[model samples]
Target: MNAFRTLATIVGGSLKNNATIECDDHGAEFFKVEINSSMDKAINHPDLTFLQGLSCRDSSSSTFGPLTLAQLSHFECGEVALSFCMLHKVGDACSAYYFLRDWARLTRDPKSTLSPPYFAMDSLMPSPFDGPMVSPVVEPKMEGCIHQRFIFSESKINALKVLVVAESCWLSGRIEKLPHLFPNSITMMVLSFSGLTEDPMPILEMLPNLRNLDLFRAYEGKEIISDNNFSQLEFLHLTELEKLKRWLLGTNVMPLIKGLGIHNCPNLKEIPQRMKDVELLKRNYNKW
Candidate 1:
């Protein structure tokens, strides 16, 4: 069988046992895909950004099933981005990860054994916790949302590390001569080219004049950006970030933020309660 055929067969066979799956009125959503050629230079570049995504968009390019669909995007650079849009109602990360792992094993060998699903989630969820909770019902309509994949090239990621470290920050202020304290010559920052293993917040702290920030699939960090970071940021766009759980904002961080777009952040639990008391946000009339 060809790649597509094999892929379809394997996915179909496994969906039968997909626990808590959401079936649309149209039945199984199967899969939808498109091949992209526009990002050849970015994807094939020696330095590349990390992977991200899965959004339910009204556009024909995106597939919004009851909530699960797999999309494989092939670029002219011979790079492929396989993204799965799965709603929390149907399945959470645990189920999705298991499904993917099983799919890989089956793709490698049809006879691979499967891990049993643990149905006793009540033990972990308890009683009151299982009660109704607030869900993400509001979807912000963003006309300025940048749809292109963000690329943080190898050299750029390295530059971030070198320029943003604690040692560099201290040395620049001291008698030690450093190359311009900070790379202030570059004001605008974009991180979409490469998958980043290190957190870019430290680097961002050094760029006080940074006004526009576009981050795509860059930080899978648990705690993103220390307090007081992004003090001078105005326009910020974060898309498809996976592991961010909390937004650490201080008294004066993002004080001048005019527009902030957050898209496809599944695990971002909540904003720090302390931010509510920040006088700067109230003075600037900024609503997060």
Candidate 2:
């Protein structure tokens, strides 16, 4: 019902499906989240960055493996910064976004009530290829498109009602003005707000020195900046972005990206027409 509750539902579902992971000691074990006070502390940490492999096409593939001490040292305590990790395209971007946001909200306020994640399992169609491997454990089927589902208790669900109501209240005005720009689903709308942006002005004003970027899809003509310039972006993400035709077509291309994600965007199955990578396409489609 509320944003925080919706997040609980997702986490509940993830736990049910055996898709969740947790670490207690900071960098004592690889799975634990590491924290620091400065970039120098992050650099000084002894953890090693490891390459993570994926078994699906969902956001699950994007999860960062145990960071090297150097990478861990990058995090600063008490400073909220956006961090990037790889996920599989099969992992629901909406579910992932709500899960984290709600988790944070619950951590801050424990009395939140959440609703169950809508499980359209019957709608998901089974895969055609039974190969040893194919990306995204779940793919869009021509017929029924089944997706995994999860839900939290009514008590937890209720606690998040206020936050969800607040977001709905905020979004109502925007939706009324631009009815056509409504997101494909609630999950997309939640992610569009939660993720970071490449805009330096907001980052500089809100954060200390503009380190992490919470990039996500901007609706058609959202006016991120009067002039489109994102040359210093370290992260780029596309989440359920159905209308990215103009953004990709723009001449201002990003050069130095440390992380990139294209998630839950059904409208963009193919790369832009102009910048298409022929060899990568061949490899992706296996047209040798």
Q: Return the top candidate by lDDT.
A: 1
List where candidate 1 sits over 4 angstroms from the true fold.
1-182, 272-288
lDDT of 2 by residue, 1-288 (tens): 243223433222231122332322221111334454554444465232221241223333343332111111224444433322323321356645655555566767778765545544323443345532343344224467577788898988888765543322123112212222322212212223322223323322222222223323434332233123434544444554454333343455333335545555565555544344322211111311
Q: What is the lDDT of residue 150 in candidate 1?
A: 89
Identify the runs in model 2 with alpha carbons over 4 angstroms from their true place.
Answer: 1-31, 35-77, 80-90, 119-288
TM-score for candidate 1, please give it.
Answer: 0.32
1-288: candidate 1 lDDT, tens digit per residue: 233234333222222122322222332233434444455654575122222343433322223333445555566566655455455545577766765666567767886656555544554455455333334233445778778888899999998776664222221111211122556644576665335555666667668677777666666566676565677677766666787777766666677777666667789867656444433221121321
lDDT for residue 266 in candidate 1, whole number 0-100: 86
RMSD score of candidate 1 (Å): 19.4
Weakest ten-residue segment in model 1 by summed lDDT: 169-178
Model 1, residue 36: C-alpha shift (Å): 77
- Candidate 1 lDDT for residue 187: 54
Model-by-model lDDT, in order? 0.52, 0.36
